[model samples]
Target chain A: MAIYGVALLAGCMMFGLIIGDLLGQVLGIEANLGGVGIAMLLLIFVTNVIHQWGKLPDSTSSGITFWNAMYIPIVVAMAASQNVAAAFSGGLVSLLAGVLAVVLGLALVPVIAGKPEPEQDCQDEPATAVASNTAGSRRG
Target chain B: MFESLIELFDEYHLIAAFAVIGLTMYLSNWLSVRFTNGKFHGSAIAILLGLLLAYIGGVVTGGENGLADLTLFSGLGLMGGGMLRDLAIIATAYGVRFSEIRKAGVHGVVALFAGVIVSFLAGGIIAVGFGYTDPVDITTVGAGTVTYIVGPVTGSTLGASSEIIALSIAAGLVKSILVMIVTPMTSRIIGLDNPRSAMIFGGLIGTTSGVAAGLAATDARLVPYGAMTATFYTGLGILLAPTALFLMVRAIA
Candidate 1:
């Protein structure tokens, strides 16, 4: 399940990249390929943050912290190290455009994958209260 | 064809970095689950491991003048060193309730974007003050960009596994170098708290800006790789701020 989730997320990123590239070309913006990647990453990060924050789980928070502290820097470093001269000389814009297109192609996966609905709050309180009452009764 | 494949594998260090980071994270998580019963707090472990691996790999593959040479390693080391510096800054900021400076709702997002922008502007000013020219106008994807684009394209064009891996790794390393140089200064200037600062610093080194800046610095032969570092710092600010801001807004909303 975890592996599947990762693959799904990766697929979504690819799709998002594609959509972002097309959007960039339509808008005629430079570096839109990156823009798309940023957008996808942001979407994933924020959505995860929000979803997990709602749960207030320690594990999730730890995951978020790990991501913020470690993953972001790694991604930034990777992007920065490219040979910009060759990228430009070889029409990096178009190539990025193509990469973006590939990313966008994968966008449909999420729609089909179906995001889980946010958990309800009321489901747990009654059970907890009952358990506490039982413990109190036993103590009495 | 074989030579090209070998060269491609030798170049793109980002893939290797990613692999290292991923593996490190996996191992850390595995250890946490085993020892702490799933209570491992995130810290410098994974990043340090990734850096060590990249350094070792570079040394093994490129030898003395290879991508992991003295200058590049030192630059990367300095860049990583900044993370420790930011950890102190973050501790201080939290000590003073600095996170409260922004509205509670959007503080994290604001902090992240501000950090990136501040770092970029500061890094740029620093670069210009230090007499570094912007190597490639982002307005057009130039030679630098082509190496990344072409590396993948060439691999795909040639349909060779070695070429693909080499190009990816070369691309990654060059990117990492650039990010390392610029991100610390930018993050420091932006006044982000510890975790965000660390992440932004990492991100700056992770992208094409790192490679671009590194190569530009190398070409200009000014302070070895100063230009590349500056470019990575500034480019990150340019590239990431908007999305960060947007995410913050959404988070608050």
Candidate 2:
């Protein structure tokens, strides 16, 4: 049944929340661990395991998709609560460091990729841009 | 009638906040598609609008919790709590197909480790420069450089102070917002049109929200590939920050 996805999500969420609470209790902190990350990891592992067993029907996948779409917009609301003001008011050094890390990451992208400035708009040159890694290149 | 309506507002504030947000999103999207000519994504615009609204709410109410501190918008605190934020991340990751992810190859693995370490190092160095000589504080904020969630988690586990933890979260959130807003603008300069590049890009920038939204704006097809590596990146950060990174900080501090 398509409802299987929701069932899987519910199960994962339950376990994740339990684990998060347990971790918080164990550490004596007022915060839970990454229950959602744990839940997502569980879903990924379970679905992959089901696929390996030849039991992952298409309907359940569709069900997961449905929830994903309906849920993503909630991200904006989450960003609203982020502590941007605190980051700024914390210290000039902290703010400088945050900006510096982002800049360093951005600057490292081209160096790590071994690509040049990509000046001419690579949208028209997609084939030439990524020729090194053909689809068959295996990690294993 | 007005006094009674105020009571009703207090009762359904959460639902009302959701409606107001929805309306705001539509306007942001319209502005993005029209004025920016698709240069700025609707999500990015919505985020900017959200920040502006939060700042105004803080100023008007003279209270913490931003808009949520107001009686009519109290539901936002619950709506924007950790549970939903984490769920949104998980749901997005659940939508990925494994086949596409496998194609990232050895480059993807390298990127993951590199992203976590580089981000952490950058953060740690900055913390020390700010006169945070304590290893615990440095490591907590350093972990936050890897991702916002990892920062506080590391802090709580390591028993860092709340002030340092808040700084860590702020650092992490700053990274996330930057990743979200900047990825689109710099995509081409960094060769971000392919999955391999996307995977590498994902590894280099470990903030999941930033990578997801940035990749979505740059190219929707690349979101899953970038997000997959990013998910792994966060897990690695969580595992390393409190232990390995802390030890490194301890030695240096």
Candidate 3:
């Protein structure tokens, strides 16, 4: 039943929140840390386990999808609720915060990805080719 | 009759909210398909539209809750509250495919943490650049660059002001849209043509919808791989941002 999916989600959320609260206490932070994230992890693990058992019926999967589809509306609602006018008038901080995020994130992609395996075979030829080209250009 | 109709809308304001949002989505999606040819996702457009409406709502009412300040749209306050927002975020985990993650291997895993750290630090640095000295404000905005959800979640936890939280969300939304638009264009340059690369990309990018849509445009086959790691990225972001990352920011700033 679809309700089963919701029940599972709710259970995971509760468990995650409790654990998060405990973790917060241990860390001496007054706020809950990672409760929503922990809950999502629990749900993923639980759903995968159920799928492995072959007990995850279509009904249950659909149940999850039904709510998952609500992602768009929820996000839109959130945007609607945000006070961007106030944020904008506050300063250039928000715009800078966003622009820097994308630029810095894209710059680090190559650094994080390193070298792809298949490209290694062809790497030597391009390396020498580019090296010679650059050397010739510098001399000219 | 008019009074009764108004009463009905008030009583069923939640439903009214759904109707209004539904209409907005329809219009946004229509514009997306008709004009942008789906290069931009409908949801992104809808979000932009929502932000615009919110600005107008705030200007019209001079109140704090944006569109929720309006009597007709008051239900948006509850609909957009932390409860439903978290629920929507948690629901995303339900769609994850476990087998797909194994293909990305070690780099995929590393990318997830790296993506979160880099994105968090980028946000934090910019927060500092803007003269925000409080660790709570800095951390919250930094987390927002990770993902919109992470921003508000971290913000509320740290007791950041509403203005800061809103900025954090905006920062995230901008990052998400940029990823969605830029990924496809840079695919060839970055070698994002393969599933493994896509996974790594997702891990580095960290926004699920953005990575998913971006991968979808680049290569439909790679969506699952990219989205799988991206999903984990959000979870990891939530876990690290508020606790470890926040502490680091607190120490540094």
Candidate 4:
């Protein structure tokens, strides 16, 4: 678990750096700044997903915590070096694109097909409820 | 080494990058929670925001130095994350009870992966048609596309961070298109009614498509479509992941 956490954190950071550089060139932005942001976001998201999905054990939570803590500093460090004006301008474009995807995705998808059923609610509720109720009666 | 690191940051202008991306991911995640009813939808939002933040940061910082290096690294990172996420989910599902696994199951995983591959292939074809030949690699471009598109869209529509929000909405629009086209076919093949499957399927497809679009759009004008393609891929991935898995299992058995 510790290894996986480390791998995830380091991997995300490196990925951020590389992708940041590439995107910076492609879109005429800054590499380090992009790298840091990508790294932090990826690390947070990946770790959060593992936790949410119940894959990582409780003992490993600390590792994820450590990684999350590190993200702020790294990002801050990266940000300290950037051209604020350009960053904001490119950011504005990125921000606009990101917003459009989410809103349209949420609104349109549901309208067309409605939301997918929650997986948890679909199974085992009645049986578990019945079992608990019977146990309560016996205790009473 | 210290000097080099400091110089690198200074050259790149790291502070603005961090602020912009940090806020981008945060806002995107917040909007996702506000709008979506699904479990872990917030996490998805976070992931997208992170990617967007990274992409924008790279673009802003690279400036005259160019993004060649950052792009390569980001692509690799995205591929690694996608693979790790896939493996983790699959392994966890297998370890649990069969009944529990059935809820989302191996089929779902396979479908999602397959959808990603399919989307990538489709995107590559589109790229080829448009005269781009960067080798249709799914790892580097997949997640970035999703983040770039979805983060902006979700953030904007909710009146949060406009750039991130706009990206999120674009991603969603792209995903929706993919889902509308692919979900029914995948559903018929896998035999599941759950919309979650469709969502996963859509995501996979959208991610793949985003990469393809990015590669194809050598010019800046076409770059925006990268987010749209990813959104479409994701929507298809989420929707069809489960059904695709089921079909694969039956065929193998």
Alpha-carbon lDDT, every model: 0.32, 0.70, 0.72, 0.35
Error of 1 at B88 (Å): 28
- What is the per-residue lDDT of model 4 for residues A60-89, given as tens digits with 9 covering 90 to 100? 655444543333222222222222223234
lDDT of candidate model 4 versus the reference: 0.35
All-Cα superposition RMSD per candidate:
17.8, 6.2, 9.1, 16.1
Off by over 4 Å in 2: A1-5, A12-63, A111-140, B1-6, B59-65, B93-95, B153-162
lDDT of 2 at A80: 57
**Over 4 Å off in model 3, which ranges?**
A114-140, B1-7, B102-253
lDDT of model 3, residue A107: 68
Model 1's A-chain: what TM-score? 0.31
Query: B1-253, model 1: which lDDT tens digit per residue?
Result: 9767445544644344345346556775576577767543212233334444455545455442222333323233323332322221121111111111111213223333343433323322332333434321111111112223223332333243553334333432333443334333232243222222222222223233342222222211111112112222323332433334224323432
Point out the higher-scoring one by TM-score: 2 or 4: 2
- Which interface RMSD does candidate 3 score? 8.5
lDDT of candidate 1 over A62-99, digit per residue (tens): 43333224433442233222233322222323333323
When sorted by DockQ, best at the front, the candidate numbers are 2, 3, 4, 1
lDDT of 2 by residue, A13-75 (tens): 778778866765675544454455456667777877888899878888777776566443455
Kindly list the per-residue Cα lDDT of model 2 for residues B13-79, writing each as its tens digit.
7787688678877998899999989778787777666656666676677665666666776766666
Poorest 10 consecutive residues by lDDT, candidate 3 chain A: A131-140
Segments in model 4 whose C-alpha atoms lie over 4 Å from true places: A1-60, A66-123, A127-140, B1-20, B23-102, B113-199, B206-253
**Per-residue lDDT of A1-140 in model 3, one digit per residue for the tens?**
97888788778878977887787678655545557656876888898888789898888777667766776676677667766565455456666766677677666666765654432334234453334222322321
Model with the higher TM-score, candidate 1 or 3: 3
